[model samples]
Every structure is written in C-alpha cells, then in structure tokens.
Target chain A: MSGAVPWNEARAQEIIDAHLGLEGPALPILHAIQEEFGYVPEAVVPQMAQSLNISRAEMHGVVTFYHDFRHAPAGRHVLKLCRAESCQSMGSEKIAKDFLERIKLEWGGTANDGSLTVEAVYCLGLCAHSPGALYDGEPIGRVDGEILDELASEAQKS
Target chain B: MTKIYVPRDMAALAVGAKRVLAAIEKEASARGETIQIIRNGSRGLLWLEPLVEVETPEGRIGYGNVKPSDVPSLFDAGFLKGGAHPLSIGKVEDHPYWAKQTRVTFERVGIIDPVNLDDYVAHGGGQGLAKAFEIGPAKVIEEVTKSGLRGRGGAGFPAGIKWKTVADAPADRRYVVTNADEGDSGTFADRMVMEGDPFVLIEGMTICGYAIGASKGFIYLRAEYPQCAEVLTEALEAARKAGWLGENVRGSGFAFDIELRIGAGAYVCGEETSLLESLEGHRGIVRAKPPLPAHVGFMGRPTVVNNVLTLATAPAILAKGGEFYASFGVGRSRGTMPLQIAGNVKYGGLYETPFGLTLGEIVNDIGGGTLTGRPVRAVQCGGPLGAYVPPSLFDTPFDYEAFQKHDSLIGHGGLVVFDDTVDMMQMARFGMEFCAIESCGKCTPCRIGSTRGVETIDKIVEGVDVEANIELLSDLCNTMKFGSLCALGGFAPYPVESALRHYPEDFRKATLPAAAE
Candidate 1:
C-alpha cells in the first residue's frame, strides 16, 4: 500500500496472479515482484511457486539463475558498472578496482551506510562512450574516478 | 512553425539530450516563439550526440554536441532561420560519417518521430507489407531468399533458407520470434531499431508471419533495454489500434499478434534455443540442436527466430525486390551490415556499409583511429565470444568468410577497438572470466571448462608453471570448442586463442619465470 511495498503475502500473491496466464510467466513474475518490493524476498518465492503450480526448487532455480534478480534489497542507489570488453578498453577495470577499494567494498557489496551498491554489468550498450556506469538505472557514459566519487557522494546525500 | 528534432534514443539521452530539449523549450518560451518539437531516434553517429536538427529552407540543418547552456546562444544566433552558428555541422546527411553509409535498414532512424505511424507510412514503411500482400507467401519467401539476407545476429545463416524451411515444415501452429535479447558488449543496433523505428521491426515481423503461416509472434527482449521495451509496447499498441496488427491485419484477413517477453539479464538467452527456453518460463539454458528452432521451437511448434536487424530489413527486401537488396554486398555476405564501431575509437558509431571493405579501412580511416591518440593495438570484432584481432591482421576484409579464415568472426558486426595501453593477458583472462560468469551450466564444457579456463589463466598470470599452464589452457579451449553444445562455449575460445596467438608478448611477460628474469 505504501510507496515501497513491504513484504506481504497478499501483495506477492496478487503480483504472481497478475502474470500467471502468460505463456512463460516465471521471469516476468519475478521481475514484477522485484519491481514492487525492491528485491525478491525469499518468502515470496514459495508463494509464487504455489501459484504457478511449480515446486519451490524450480522457482528458486529461476530466481538464482538470472543475474538481474536481487536476493536482498539493494542500497538506495545502485551503481551497475560495465566491465566488458568495450568498457575495459577505456580503463573501466582500473576505475572499478579503484572505486571498490576507495569504498572498501567488493563487487555486489552495498556500502556500509546503505548509500550505494556496486554491481558488475556485462555491457550497458553505451559502447561509443565506454567506461559507462548506470546510476540508479540511468546510464552515465565516459565514467572516471572523479565522476564516480561525485555520484557516490550525491547518492549518500539522497 | 519551425520544427526541431532531438533524439530520444538512450545513447543520446545519456549525453544530455533531455537537458538540451528542456533548454530549447525554455529559450523558445522566453522569446515567445511557437515551434514544433519532435522527439526522434538517434542518427547513430554517437560521437556528436545530443545532435539537434532544425528544418530550414536549405534542409534539416544540424548542430552537433549541443548542451543545455548552448540553447540560449543558439537562439540568439537565429538558428531557427538556419543562421550560421559555431555548433552548426550543416545538414546531417551531408556529414561524411552519414553520407557514405548505405542506410537500407536505418533509413528512417533518427529522421522521423519514432512512434508516429503517419510519419512511418510517409517514409516507405507499409510498402513492404503492401508488396508482401501482393506477392503472396511463397513469392515473399522467394524474394527474401533471392536477396541473400543472412542472420545478422553473428551467425550468417541465410534468412530466406531459414524462412523457407519454416514455411514448408508442417505444423499445427507456427510462431515468429525476434531475438531482441542483444546482450553483446559492443552492440546497440538492435536497441536502436527497437527504440528509434519500432514499427519497422513490427512490419518486418508481420511480413515474416505472413510468409511462414504464423499467427503469433513474440520479441524476446532483454531487461537492460527498458527504453526499447517501453517504446516497442507503445508502438505495438498503436499498430493494433490502426489495424496493422491483431485478428485481421491491414484487412488481409491474416490473424497475427505479437507479445513482448522480457529476459532477466542472461547473455546466453541471445542464443536461439536458449531464448526459446527462456520464452517458455524455464532457465535460460542452451539446448542441443539438430531440430533447430525452425522445425521444433516455441512450445515445440515450428518457429522462425530472427535478429532485429534481419527482421527489420525484411520490409526493404520485399518492397525493393530481392535482387536490388542483394546487389550491395560482397561474397556470401549480401546486403548492408550495420557495423557498430565502439571502444577507444574516435568516431565510434554505427556505420552500415557493404561487405568487402578491409578492417583497416573501418578502423583507421572511418574510425579515425584511437580516441587516446595512441597507436592502435587490438580490435575485438563481434561480441564477447568473438576473436581479438591484432594490428597485423587489420587488412582482413569485413566479410564473414574472411574473418573465419583468421579464426575470428564478425559476430553481430560489433568492432571494439583498443589502444596500445591494453594488456592482452588481462583481456584474455576477461574472455574466460566473462564466459564463466555468464555460462548457463547446461553443458559441462561451458560451465566447468569456463571455470577451469579462468583458473588456468589466473595461474598463467601468476607465473605458475607458465608453459604447461598455457598448454593446459589451449587443451581446455579445444575441449570446449569440440565438446560444447552451443556457441556460448564453442566460440568462447576465440577471444582466448586470438589474444594468445596475436599478443604472445603480453602472455610471456606476465608468466615469465623468476629464473628467466
């Protein structure tokens, strides 16, 4: 009912039922759950499995298999850094390493203050402007340390 | 009223197009001038993004790399009247990057309002469908076959042959599936088509449906492209409202409707069988082929799975006839390929050119060399699964066959350039690491072999048993190449092998023994 839907059995069931009629509803249903609850709560999986007429193992497998599905709530701002070939050519590896070391966090680790979570994305399709990063799902191109630091500080403020 | 065009393509938006659009609006309001603002798709020349165009007496006069702050200045210079300004790049089509391009598929991209059905119709949109209806299904397949159009999603299988097989195959139900899960690193052409000119994809898919006797269609889109998904949904709704799609499309009595299925961040899903598996609500795992998707696909019914470009180009092939389309290409690679130049290149963008141009021309001449102004070292053609080409082999023609001869591939036509500063060993390790990370665990060689590859490369980097480890890595690559079920593992060796062969110096330096030192 609130802006960020809290973990509720009724809400999860509603989301699962909304997509159950589709041909392949597992991924879509999972995506909808994440969209609604910020993350796919472990509690919601069983409910979704039950509604879809599949076992809990099958539902859990689908959830864990894809990289986009978050098992836990991400920080207020999620930073998806591109570590693929195009980005690497423009010094993304160093940028990623330096940023992680600066924040004292590793890949997929949220900052202690809950301001940021850094995840490695294969590519953002912004190859022309390499060393790209997505700040809260909006892409930022030609990324460097200064830009990343500014973004992190801004995220902390928000 | 003066009409101004600003791209809503994600790449353009990434570089402050929204800000520029707002600024233009604000500046216009202040001057009390009435102007029509059109949100079009990008022209694919990404280096000069936020490119704003104004309809002037001369033509659509262009301004490159316009920022929010420049809007007021542009207004002051009477840019609406095509007055000279510092940012003016003249007409967009006259730009050298655009002029030379043979834009068959991308003719309408960045030029028209993406969702405007009227604009699409005005610019040779429905002609393909009209032509397809006139020729009938069998003749449509013949036209596509004669055009020599191949799958643009890396594998250069002829599109017509695939369609013919699906058409001839006896099935109770058939479906047309577009592989819009474009997860390749240096590729964005599919995204461009889906966002900028979504109706073209719709038209192409609908034509495919008519040709193959399919009544249902689906676009297996990636989740990363939220903009494309939104635009495509809007476009599909509009097409349905206009009777272009639904139970009876364009009064032809051919019942066909398309559904959009979003993928949850799996690169392997770009593979056809894996895509079908994902479409069916299962894990995005590779399936062993022999019964290709054309024969047994999408709920075990015959399905025609095609890339966005391959489908989008269908309209032109139908409208202009197959021979006209086939006349542009060299060798077996017919029609124009949208070569996406990316990474450290100066003029990194999409260039749709005919095959037969040497790789050197694409990199040195058209690309204008590295962005760092350093000597070019390596270029990775195609996606992550493609080979790393050294400067020595830059002369190889931009053809599928030519790249194959050099143990490389033009997978999806994405060229990622690297300067001399790149460490080949690091790049090679990344290839194995990426494979390990994205492998679906469907095949043992892909899942385990990729992990072993990463470990072996790490050992090589750590100078552990140097020569023996290299030998082991090669052996592992061979096993994966021969034993793997899909291209995910089979072609993973391309980057590793190419990197090692081309830049042995980097490997030797990383793994040199202390005794040798």
Candidate 2:
C-alpha cells in the first residue's frame, strides 16, 4: 500500500540530497523517492538528474529500465501475481486470468475506485510454494481463486 | 525453560506462520505456560511449514503444517515437552528429508538464530574468516582453486580463477561484488542463505575481500526479496557492531565493510557485467567480454563477483580445506549443491547433496514424484532458460557437464517440474515470450528474434505451414543462441529446442485439429 501522502518535491529533494554522497546513488535515490511517493514521480526525474549531474533522459532510462519503478502511484494496495515458470506449472496463469476477469481488469491495472492494483511479477522466489503472490509486500503462497477473491475483497474493504 | 522453535522464513510466513506464532502465544498465556520461542530459518522441508519444533530432553521434536487452529490441540497434547501427537514427525533431524542433505552451505541456516552474532559464532560461523586470515590472501585463493568450486550462478565458471584474476590485476582499489539478483524461477537458495544465515554470506564476502585486498563490498540484492534485504541489513549492522565488519574486522587490522544495494526488478542484472552497470545506477544492459568484470569492473576497478551460494560455501572450504569439499561431489562439480525442487512436486524444497544423483532419483525418490499424482511429463532443470528434460533422459546425472551434454543446464540448481497434462507447445511459446519481455535489448538476436520466435511457434501451433514454421523456428533458435550478447538471448531457445526435439506430439496434436478444420 502506498500514496499515503501526496507527491512532495521538498521531501524528494531531501531524499536525493541524503543519497548524493554515496557512490552510484541513482538507484538508491529512485528507491527512496518511490518509497515515500508510492511511485517515481515524473516531475522529480529532472530534479534528480540535476542533483546527480546526469541528463533527464539517463535518469528516466534508469527508472524505466527496472520493472519495479512505477510511473504513476499504484492503488491503496497492490497484488502482484507470479507468472514465472514455477507458478505457471502450478496453475498461476489460470488463477491470475480468472481473478482479473472477475474484477474487469487487466495486468498492471488499477481499480476504478482505487482500491487495488493487480500486476504480474516474474518470480518472488517463493517457488516451493508455487502460485505465490505478494499482496502489499506480504507473500501469499498456494494462491487459488478463493484466496485471490478474499485478497481483493480485503483490499477493497481497507 | 521449555524452548519452542518457529520458522521466520518468508515461505513459513507466507503460509501463516505469523498467525501460528500469535496463536501459540495466546494459547500459552491461557494455559499459564512459560515458553521460550525462538524464530529460526526454515529447515528446507517447505511442504511441512510452519513446522513447530519443541526442544526435548532427547531431541527437537517436529510438527508439520501447524495452522493457528491446530495450536490448541498441540498445547493440549503437551507439545512443550515433546508429547506424542498426530502432527508430530519425531525428531526433525531424523526426518528422511533432513537425514538426506549434506548441508555444507546451509548447515547453520535452520539451526540458529539468523541475526544473533553469538548464535552464529556458537554454530561455527567465524572459523572460516579466521582460517582465511591464518592462511593469508594467496593461500586462500589456492585453497578455493583446489576445491574446484564453480560459479553457482548458472554459468558454472571456476570461482577461484575469477578471484585470482581480480587479485592479480593492477588496480588502485578492488571490489567484492555479490550478484544476489536471484530472478530465476524455482530458485531461492540465495534468498534462503541471506534470510536464514546472512552471516555465512557476510563471512564469505569478507574472506573474498581479504583474499583480493578489496576493502569494500556490495551485495546487489533483488527488490523481490524484501525479507532478505531486511534480514541482510540487520545482519550487516550487527556484524559492524561486533568488529566482524567495517574498519579492522575482528581486530585483524584489515578494513573490509559490506554495503547492501537493492536491485530494481531486472533479471539481466544477475549477469556480472549488467550487475555492475545496475550498481553504477544506470540501465542494466549487458557488456561484452574479454575485459570481464574480474579484470575491470565497478567504476573501472578489479572486481571479484560471485553468487551467494558460491561465496557462502567459501568459509567452509577455507576452514575444512579444499580437499574436504572436493571429496563430496562428482568430477568437475565439487562440493554440495542446494538443489531447489519446485513446481508441481510432492516434496518440493531445498535438497543439498553431492552431484552425480540421477534426475530420476531427484524427481521420483527424493521429491516423491509430482504433487498431482500424475506422471511427470518433463522437468526444466535450470531456470526459465533451461531445457525441458524428458523422462527418457532421467538418467542424466546432476552434474554441470552431464546437463550440458543433453542441451540442458544445472543453472542455479533449480528444477521446475511439469506434470503429464502440460502442453509442450505452450511451454515453448512461453519460453520465447519470457525472453522477449526480459531481453536487455543490447543485441538484435535476442530482442527481435524472441518475438519472432513467439510468432513462429504460434503459426506452427495453428497448423499454418507446420513443417516450414518448424524449420524457421529451429533456424531462429540457432541464430539467438550464437548471436546474442549474453545468456538471456543465448539460452532462451533451450526450452523451445528441447520441447520440439522430445515432445513433438503436443505440437502435432495442436496442429491436427486445425489441419482437419
């Protein structure tokens, strides 16, 4: 869950300033910004580049290159279903597809009411417990339709 | 005081270990019982998690799959004193799964409090670093070289030679970089080592720093493993406080400190050069070889990069001597591998044993076959890029060369099993699609060829010129294998090629319906 506070430029600067001392601080700075703002705000990309003495395109490239760095703020909660090999073998694809269809959503889609955002993750390393997911940073294993429905309902309620 | 153990591992928590912990505390309070609960790492018996262990006069008795609801029954049965119960599986050490593992790298993972410095020392943790200091830098490299230790990060490159290159190279400063970006499916050994026994990795990295004369180290952990990141951060701080890290490690007057760097979700960063690029806060694109990461890396300095498992095993090799480790596995692949058995398996978990075990032994005997009670159609021996191994090739030993001989790999020792109902055509298509999505786009063959591969497979499946498309697909695979800059494109064809070679029936079955129509 993120977007608790609106995007703050001053706070983003403070986050950028703190990490600028370290060698190769771009990724860490981006991570901190996302941690506070829920996503890497486009407005702050140029700011970060200016501070780090790199071009905006370079900063944007770095941010966009990694899948974890979101452009817009996610919903109040995020549900990342594993679509990797292990989970696929255990039927995660069907589980994910059914749940998305039931919710009238697609992969990386945020709900209309802004309750949940469903995304596809390659692997969470919970392979032994295949068909696993991370619901707001908590790993849920052996995920089925019922579990997904329950997770969705819980997210909506919260 | 009666002591009870509950796993704090992510897999344990995923299946409601947190709820179980709370329930146990509530139940203990209701019964007016005083209990000492220690949160330890998983025993690698994943199917039996939230495995609750009770320290008895005889040994640690185990209970499998203990839900929160099952807590009261466990308490009523007097499980504190290791009382008899239906869920009880006897002493955990005596369990068939526990008994089978050699556990060189994972010896202390499930046995001790992961973050506690003293618990680490009590369980024989720092002995390797002490041994590293005693033998000095060159001798440490010599020991690792003699151990025949290869990179556990899928490539199977000799780790000692990599270190020796970094050490001998001329540099103002050097670095010990650990590629902890464990993105491969069916692999969690890196996550386990970091979460279970962070000290072992820390110790191993320190040994590398000591050997290579690198004062600084960085562990580029993946963003997916938040728990590992948390545990590793805590472990690093603890190690620093204990004089085992930072300036003057263990009063040895050698300055070696480790900084934890979290990777953004990029699978290619698992590759050494791309990892170095990611560390530099840039786009994670592959670098050409010749001046490998060993010679010049991480801001143009000599770097010693190794996988978590490879580094974690270093301490044991130094302490016990290389020959002790060399004696464990088959030819070329020395020491034990913590093979992760996952996907559709009955007893899926981490199994650490010597090389040379047949694929049949692992799947049928150790794994107890498929979880669905169906025949295993195929098992992908490595990660997503690994070839689909048919049942006919089940006799293939779990060695690097043996797997390579079959156009398969022992990549990170992760085996994702598939049941008989699996569609090989779909699996092959998914392999190409995965490559298309994950390709770093540094090379043409991987970036463009993978998408073409998907289209070609789709055409063949739809009965549209099947023979011609198959030929096209094979040619496409050949080009990607040889033309790609790195393994992302280079090895993406393994599953596709293997599926076509072994399971042509599935592809034909799909085509037959369209052919009739």
Candidate 3:
C-alpha cells in the first residue's frame, strides 16, 4: 500500500493464478506476475522460478526477453521523445540532444531529480507532429524547441 | 436520474480528463444532481476527448473535450439531465463519423465504462461467447473465414486462414498469442481497443482457443502501456470470475484460459515470430519464417500469432456473421479498421471507418488538415517501419492492396500528418537509427547496418562528403533490406528509400555540395 504496489504476497498469488498444469505455462505466468507488479522484482524472480517449476535463470531469461517489462521505477513522468524517422526528419536529433542535455540524462535514463525519465520511443502515431513526444503517456505532435520547453515546464508542475 | 459516460483511457487523462472527472463528480453532487457516470473509451473524436456522453431516453447526447470549469455551464445547460450543450452533437449515435463506421469489433469501446464489467455485459460484451457456446468450433472458424478479416497489425495476413491452419494443426498443445505490442508512432488503435473493450479481446482469444483446440492464450502487451496492461489484467481476472474464461468456458465442455504477458521493452517484438520468441522466455528477437508459427510456434507447438486488433475483431465476426463484416471493404481488405489519427492536425483522434476511404479524405476531411494550418507535406502511414507518402498519393484508398500499389501499407492504422516544415533526410536516418537501436542484434544487416546507417547520415547532416555519404547510406539501407533475416532489418529501409525518393530536396538542401554552398 505504501510503495511501488508491492511485489510481494498479493503478486505471488497473481503468479500462482496465472497458469495451469499445462506444458510451458511459465511464460504466461511470469507475464501475469509482472503485470500485477510493474516489474519482475529481484525478489519475485526467485518466487516465480519456484512456482513455475523452472530455474531462476530461465525466469531471468524471460524477464529480459520481452521489452515491455521493466525493473527500475519509472520517474514520476516518462518523457518519450520520438527518435523515429519522421520526428528525426524535423530536427528530432537536435530536440533529443537538447532534451538529454537539458535534463542531464541519456536515452533510457531518468533525470537524477526523479522528475523525468527520457526514453527514445520510436513514434507516438503523430507523424505530422514530425518530432513528436509523449509526456507521461499522452502523445503530442509538432514538438519544437518551444514545445519541448513548454512540456518540460508542464512536467515540473505535475 | 442522468447517466453519463466519461472516457478514463490514459489518452483522455493526459489531456486533463482526471480534473474533468473530479469536476463532474463534485459539481453533480454540489447541484444535488443525480448522475450515473461511466468512464468509457474515446469516441475517436479526440479533438473532443474527455467526451462525456449523457444518457437520454433515446440515446446518449455528447458534450465534451470538457474542462473542469466547463462543468458549471454544462450543468446550467441541463447537461446533468442529458440536455443539448454547445458541444452536444444531439443524438450522439447519429454523428456521421460514428454512423458510417460499422464498428463490430469496437462496439463496446465508446459505449461502456472500460473497467466496469457490468456496463460491458449490459452492452452485450460476451454475447459472442454466449453464441459461440451454442455453435461448434468449426462453425465459428467458418464464420471468421467468411468475414475475410485480414490482420490489422501491419501484415495483411488472412485471419481466417491463420485460424484454420492453427485449428487444424496436429499439435498436442496449441498456443494463441495476441501481439498487443503496439509500438507504431501514430498507432494507438490497438491500445485504445484493448483498454476500452478488454472483454472483446478475452472473448476473441477464447474463441480462438476453441477454434484451434488450444486450452490457453497469451496477450504479449508492451510494458510502456501500464494502464492498458492493468485494465487487461483486471479484465482477465473478471473473465475468469464470470466463467467467461477458465476451465470449460461457458460450461460447453471446452476448456480455455488466457493470461497477460508483459513484454520488457522491444519494438521489434511486435513482429509475430519475435513475439513468439519473447513469449517463450528468450530475447525478443525475430525468428526465421517458413515454419511460420502456425505449424510450429510458442514452445514448439502450433500457435496462432495475431495482432491485438485482429483478435479483438473476432467476437464481432462471430456475433454479426462474417458476411456482415466482408461487405464493408473495397478490395481484398474487408471490415472496419480503427484509424488512429494523431499529430499536427485540427481533428486528431481515432476514426473507425471501413477500408477504402482515400488518404485525402482521412487527412484533409477528417483530420481538418495540419495543426499549423499550413499545406500538408507528407503523411506517414503505419508506424516507424511504414512508408511515407507525398501529397501526390493522397487520392489513394486505404486498403492493403491500394497502399501496396503506392509502395505503402496501412500498418496498425496510425496516420501521422506532417506539414511543410518537415525534412525527409533526417526522417530517413531515423528509420535506420531506430531499427539499429531496437534490433535484437541477432543478424548483421539490421544490427550493424543500422548503426552505420546512422553514422553515414550523421556525416551528411554535418556536411561531410555529402553526396558520397548519401549514396553509401542508401546502399547500406538496401543491403539491410535484402540481407537481414527479418523485417526489423529488412523493411526498415522502406521509409528511408521512400523519403529519399519523394522528398529528395530535403536531403540535398541540408547536405548540399561544397561547391553549391
């Protein structure tokens, strides 16, 4: 109740409930556990290995296999600037560079202040906004230096 | 007693739906108004998102893109009593956009509270499943096949054919994997449908299981989509609780179950084979084709790997009958697609129309042109991997064949519009760089070629060996296309090539010859 939704007991049951006695139910079960808890915590990995009757290495392999699962806590805001073709076409390289420099963060990294995490997302479905970006999860288009500045300010207020 | 539906999907929230929800709740109580509000999905009318549908005796009246302050005036206008507000498109059901769209797949999306199962059921959430129980599995597959529903997730593979193959495959354990890893730039239709009508996805997979004689399913959703995943997990549990899923679904002597599989963070995993590999506890890398998942996939068993929209469309295909779906399209592509319209445009959002609508109509008519109010430059159909089309191809229809004729494909139905200010060279480089970063490092072409492609383009941008560097970059993109094992490496060059061809001036202008400069 207090923290990152606890990767503990309730999550353990969610994992247990994710599978049946069928062949190779480990993957689906791991996915379910991670869904309940944002990440497949180091603590839960061992628990899942035991519950799914697989090795911890196997569980770790799974935890690393797909790109959707994450281990670290997301910053209060996840600022995904489109590093895709269209966005990059309209000076996204500069925008991304600016974002990295301004926030003092690299791609796939969070700002030390924990206010923002900058990730290089491919696209936010706003090609017209060439150089698009998503603040938290909402997609915004036509992102220029000015727009980025406005977004940076917006994120700070939240 | 007034009933209202507010969209609680993350998109609506990002645009201040949270504050609006509180306003509606607080104001209704303050005015001592009796209001029953349900949070549904967007009406694809995103310009008017946080779209509030107040129920009337005939149907729900629309009022939205609302702000917290707008609630006072809206209340005064008898909005709490489902009266016509300024934003109200009286008799919301009759709106041309909604009326024209034969939304069998997305029927439950904008109508009911996404997280509320009671609302979902009341709106006929599991009706297909109920009907599925009465008919045999073969009959269900027959209906889907008759519908001519192609996979909406980029590749226009025949959905019925895929199901029939999996259904008839000789395997002890068949698996059904829904590729919900929607990483396309302009494509939120997958996420929107998943978050709005999760039960449709559940019912779809269950029906898929019954069709393929598989007992289990996995929805390999992207991790970035936390909200969608959360709702899906809840819906999965809800389905199990309500006997819509779990052992012997519908007590029809057929057992099937589904679980949400969260992908770590790979865009290439959106590909079916890579998705299958990722689901099977390996790096989200693309697997070789020919053994095509249908014959052998997801743990060396027969598996049906499909897109989220493809699976979501199944329930309706069964409920309304396949012929009903097949009648709507222009060419080989049939049925309605949830077109995700985003970016610099006045009218940006989802438009669920039948296939065959021209790119011109979608961009100029529905999108209301560019947000900058300038003449539109180019529209990128599909995600990063899709092709870029110039204004010349604006008149082309949106079906797979039509797009393919234009050297494009409607990948995931995300149409991103750009104005005159865009440069094509940088866009081309991004295709290479993105593939480079997202590549699983399995093969050389995609893995190394992408990095080189980025470096080569960087040289051009920096005005170093301009023309030669451009040729080298183009050559590298071509090699990556033919030589790479998968589309991650192969098809990435599509955007790069198309950009270079359509807007040659953009690249030449930025990286002009030293003599020209």
Residues B115-211, candidate 2, lDDT per residue (tens digit)?
A: 9999999999999999999989999999999999999999999989999999999999999999899989999999988889999999999999999
Error of 1 at B213 (Å): 1.0
Per-residue C-alpha lDDT of model 2 across residues A65-138, encoded as one tens digit per residue? 99999999899999989999999999998989999999999999999999999999999989989999999989
**Residues B187-218, candidate 3, lDDT per residue (tens digit)?**
77887888888888988888888888889898
Those runs of model 3 whose alpha carbons end farther than 4 Å from true positions after fitting are A1-100, A109-116, A123-158, B115-118, B121-124, B510-517
Predicted structure with the largest DockQ when compared to the true one: 2
Clashes of each: 0, 0, 22
lDDT of 1 by residue, B167-271 (tens): 999999999999999988999999998889999999999999999999999999988787788899999999999999999999999999999988988999999
> Each prediction's TM-score against the native?
0.98, 0.99, 0.88
The residue-level lDDT of candidate 3 at B435 comes to: 84
Model 2: residues >4 Å from true position, as ranges?
B513-517
Candidate 2 at residue B288, lDDT? 96
lDDT at position A51, candidate 3: 76
Q: Every model's DockQ, to 2 decimals?
A: 0.81, 0.91, 0.34
Top-lDDT structure, candidate number: 2
